[model samples]
Target chain A: MTFFEAENVSKNYAGHTALDHVSINVKEQSIFGLLGPNGAGKTTLIRIINQIIGPDTGELRIKGEKLNPDHIAQIGYLPEERGLYKKMKVGEQAMYLARLKGLSKQDAYSRLKKWFEKFEIENWWGKKVEELSKGMAQKVQFIVTVVHEPSLLIFDEPFSGFDPINAELLKQEILKLKDKGATIIFSTHNMSSVEELCDNIALIDKAKVILDGEMQSIKQEYKSNAYELKVRDLQKDINEILPSSFNLKKIRALNNCQSFVVELPGNVTSNELLSQVMPHAQVSSFEEILPTMNEIFIRKVTEAGRSK
Target chain B: MNKIFTILRREYLSRVKKKSFIIMTVLGPILMAALFVVPVYLANVSDREMKVAVLDETGLFYDAFHNSDKVEYENIYMDYATARDQFEELDYDALLHIPESALNNPNSVKLLSTSNIGLNMISDMESVIQKKLEAHRLSLSGIDKKVLEDIEVDVTINTFIYKEGEEKQNYSEISYALGLISGLLIYIFIFLYGAQVMRGVIEEKTSRIVEVIVSSVKPFQLMMGKIVGIALVGLTQFVLWVILTGLIVFTFQTINPDLFKYKSPEQQMIENKGLTPDELAVQQENLELSNDKANSLLEGIRQIQFGNILIMFLFYFIGGYLLYASLFAAIGSAVDNETDTQQFMLPVTIPLILAIISMQVVLNNPDGPVAFWMSIIPFTSPIIMMARIPFNPPVAYWEIGLSLAMLVAGFVFTTWLAARIYRTGILMYGKKASFRELFKWIRF
Candidate 1:
């Protein structure tokens, strides 16, 4: 079920179009990756979802209800340029943000305590945000974004300033949030994390969604018909055994096995290719190679730019 | 509404808890109270008695000096050279010598002192000598002094304002002071609190917390929350200043009861005569209606409608603050930092500055064209109207009503325009804001 929906949302700033007829549906209990390049309207779309700025045309709904002020309490957003009041104490700032999200003081305090303890920064509560390291402040920001237990959480460039270990920790916490039934809209230029964490995505380029849908399905759709095969022993030449239609793209010799990649024809199937190669060589392992989200993103964005 | 409250509470508490806020709150009262107490203390400190010795070679001005509370006179039966030689031993503040030709040349009399003698003492001696010389000349002409005194005429003009077919005493000077003071106070408050609002906005914007904040609340709510929050701070500071200043003045009055007394010049002169009660009554009778002018001035103060002035003062202060604070917030949002606000600050501040600069003109002629138009223009009305309100022929009710209505309308219009710019500007980063860009933001 769609937990949040922005339908045909168009936003124009002065003379420039920021978001043009953009639509995004965030499913319940899933991570929706909003991938785009600089000035591609990703932040604008995220802002619309957060209701920070309204779409000039179109409507937004949360849980089948039209988005309104009350919905503000249900949505928590961490923008790319997010920051705490630098002079405010970490714990106090967290409580403030949580209360702003409609949490009671007692609830905010307790939840903040739990989050601080979990992040192992309980001692830094009295410290001002300016006193915190970039990674630490990011952690605090993430905690505040989710402290209210918002059903829909949006984080833009969440892992930009985080080290690898902390990024991993954040990824786990994000997965845990989804497990707890919170839908997240993650906007970033980081494609690797998208592949690892996102279940659904919309690739927006030039104020339009060039690609979107289930992450697995997009990868599946964009995948060229190619497979990597590992042979322990080859009795015949690969080109001689395979049909002319099968194009061998690359080959590498290993210590105990020969690995080669082949592109299948439109009429051919991986299983058929495996069957045809089985008699000719010892096929130890065979698997299809899928396109990474990074490649798909670049190819789609470049194509959109060219088409425009 | 709750969200706005949340934001307001944060904005207020964050600032109110700052060291600077605490410092200003405590220091502002001291500075204001000094304005009330320092002058009174200085005047009392300078009221010391001085003694003068007169050496008259002409022997025509004996017993002519009158001694009051501040100055004492002693006549020395000796030549000017001897008096001048004995001046330090005599311990007189000054030696006043009258030459033989003093009757012909008034400037022939000289005063010699080891230290600087006050101008008051010099003037007193000159007046006493001149009166004695005039009497001497009059006696030579065989004219009676009492007859001459009886013939002296003192004319006084009392301005009466005919309002609503009724005569009312008008104290133009008092009204001018009241109007100027109140107008100046409003001007200060608007600028002081308006800049605070701007700084608060810039802090939020530069720290990049505005986006997070606006995401939770509407930009309008955030802007208003800040404006209202800082206004509360201003009000709190103002109330503390009033109370503290009142306490200081009250304490001073209790400590020195005579310091606050309104002693008229006639009363002081009568007391200086050292006459018995009967003689004082006769002197007061001879003083004529000139003494009534002083009493009537005191009465004019009591007759002034202070309650009306106070109510209007509050209305204008709050109205003016709201009108300007919203614009300050808009400018703050448009800029990246305080330095970047220079371009936008000039336009927003011009009308307020104009109102302040035009206040002098308004006070000079409260009923003139400049006052009338300025009091009606919403941008200038808060100050101009305040200046006109305290005048004798009071500002017309319709004019005040129209000005207030325009002020309210102007506040609404500026707030609308500011909100549009603020909502867009808060989210826009990196680029410096210009007037054209701000106008574009309003359209957005």
Candidate 2:
């Protein structure tokens, strides 16, 4: 079921358009990756979801109801430029934010204590935020973001300041939250993390969503017709044996096998290419090469720029 | 509303908990009390009796100088040269000399001290000599001293104002003081708490915490909560100052009852000395008249409709603060740091500064056109109208009501405009803010 939906949302600042007809749907218990380059209107869309700014045109619905102020209690937002009151104590600041999210003082305190204990930084509760190291502050911020147990949590560049170990720890925590049936809108430029955790994504460029769908399906759709083949004991050159429809892109010789990268033209099947190469050399292994999210992002953004 | 309260609580608690806030709250009244007590104490401690020796060569002013708490005079029989040589043995502060030609050369009389002669001592000598000279001339013209005394006249004007066909006593001096004080007070309050609102906004923006905050609550709520929170802080400080200053002054009065009294017993004693029955009767009547003036002043103050002035004061106080604070918050939002706020600060502060600068004009001519228009214009009304409240023939009901209504509308309009600018300005970063850019944000 769709947990949050922004339909045809558009926003303009002064005379400049920040977002135009931008829309994204986040499903319950799924992680939605909001992918975009800087100033691509992704932040604007997230802000609209958070209700920090209203869309000039279009509507937002959460769980089949029109989004309103009460829904703010159910949504937690960790902005890209995240910060805590530096002069305030760690636990006090967390309690304050959690209370702002509609948690009672007692509940905020207990939940904050639990999060602080789990993060193994319970001693930091009394320490001011300015006293914490950058990594430590990031961990505290992550805990604060999720402490209210909000049904929908939005984290923008959540792992920007984390070290590898803490980043992995945060990833596990986010996955655990999703397991507990929370909807997540994850916005970042880190495509590797998107590939690892996102179930669906929308890539926005220049105020428009250029690409969006289920992660795997979108990756599948973006894959070119290319395959990597390993063959050994060849009787003839593989390139000479293949028809002109199969373009051999690169060849690399290993100790026991020769690797061939072949691009198949339209209407050409992998089976046909395998069969054509099999007669000339024994095919040890064959695999289709799908595009990485990074490659797809670069390609789509570049294409959008050129078209513009 | 609950969210705004939450934000207000945080804003208020965070600041009130600061060490600086606590220190200032305690120190403010002590400093104010010191401003009063220090000068009085210094004056009392430094006042010393100076003794002057008069050497009158004309020998016509032997009894002219009178002894008082501040100065004493003694007639000397020695000549000027002998007195100058005997000054060390005489142990007197100064030696006065009069040449025989001093009858025509009035400036020939000289006072010489080993150290610098105080101007007070010189004035005392000149006045005594002048009084004696006048008496001598009056005698030469065959004029009686009693006649000269009877010819002196003193007149005082008693002012009254007719309000609603009833005659009421009016004290223009008291009204002038009251108006200036209340007007200046409002000006101080608006600036003190308004800048606090601006600094609070700038802190949130520079620290990057505004985004995190606005996500949960509306920007308008945050801005208002902060402004109201700081206003509460200012009120708290002012109340504490009033209470503490009162306590301090009261304690000092109790310890030394004569600290604030204007007249000393010695002065009364000197005035009563050598007064004939008829002269004493006139003096007693004059004293009673002065006492009646004081009583009338008190009665006038009691009848000045302080209730109306107080109600209007509170209305303008809140109205004026809200208007300026919202604008300050908007300016803070548009700037990245305190330094960048300068360009925007001037325009917002100009109206308040103008109101303060024009207070003199209002006080000088409270019923004039300049005062009337200034009191009606919302930008300057908080101060100008407050100053006109205690004046003669009082500010009209419709004028007060109209000014107040306009103030409410003005604040509402500025708040709406400021909220627009603040919402957009907080989200914009790293850009120098200008009036044109702020205008753009207002449109946004």
Which lDDT tens digits does candidate 2 get at residues B1-444? 888999999989998899998999889889989988877765565357787888989988776776776677788998788899989899888778877777778889888788777776688678768877777779889997668978987787888888789987778888899899999989998998899899899888877888988988999999999988987887777778878988998898898877766554334534845556775676676677666776787787887887788788878888888888999999999998999888888988899899899999899889989899998888889999999998878888999889989998998998999999999889888887788887877775
Q: Provide the lowest-lDDT 10-residue window in model 1 chain B.
A: B260-269
lDDT for B360 (candidate 1): 85
lDDT of 1 by residue, B1-444 (tens): 887888889888988899998898878777877887787776556457888787888787666776767778888888777777877899998888899898889889898988888876788788878988998889889997667877887776888998779998889889999999889899899999999999988888888888888888788989998998888888877777778878878888999898767554456667665456764665687565765876888888887899899899889988899999999999888888898888888888788789889888888899999999988888888888988898878788999999999999999999999999888888879888778888788876
Candidate 1 per-residue lDDT, tens place, A114-206, comes to 999999999999999999998999999999898888899999999999999999999999999999999999998899999899999998988
The count of residue-pair clashes in candidate 1 stands at: 0
Tens digit per residue, CA lDDT, model 2, A1-308: 99999899999877778888987888999999999999999889988899999899999999989999999888888888877788999888888888888888999998888888899999998999999998998888788788888899999999999989999999999999999999999999999999999999999999999999999998889888999999999998675898887788899999988999998996888999988888788899999999999999999999999997
Off by over 4 Å in 1: A224-289, B46-48, B78-88, B97-111, B116-153, B264-290
Clashes of each: 0, 0
For candidate 2, give the lDDT: 0.87
RMSD of each: 4.1, 3.4
TM-score for the second chain in candidate 2?
Answer: 0.88
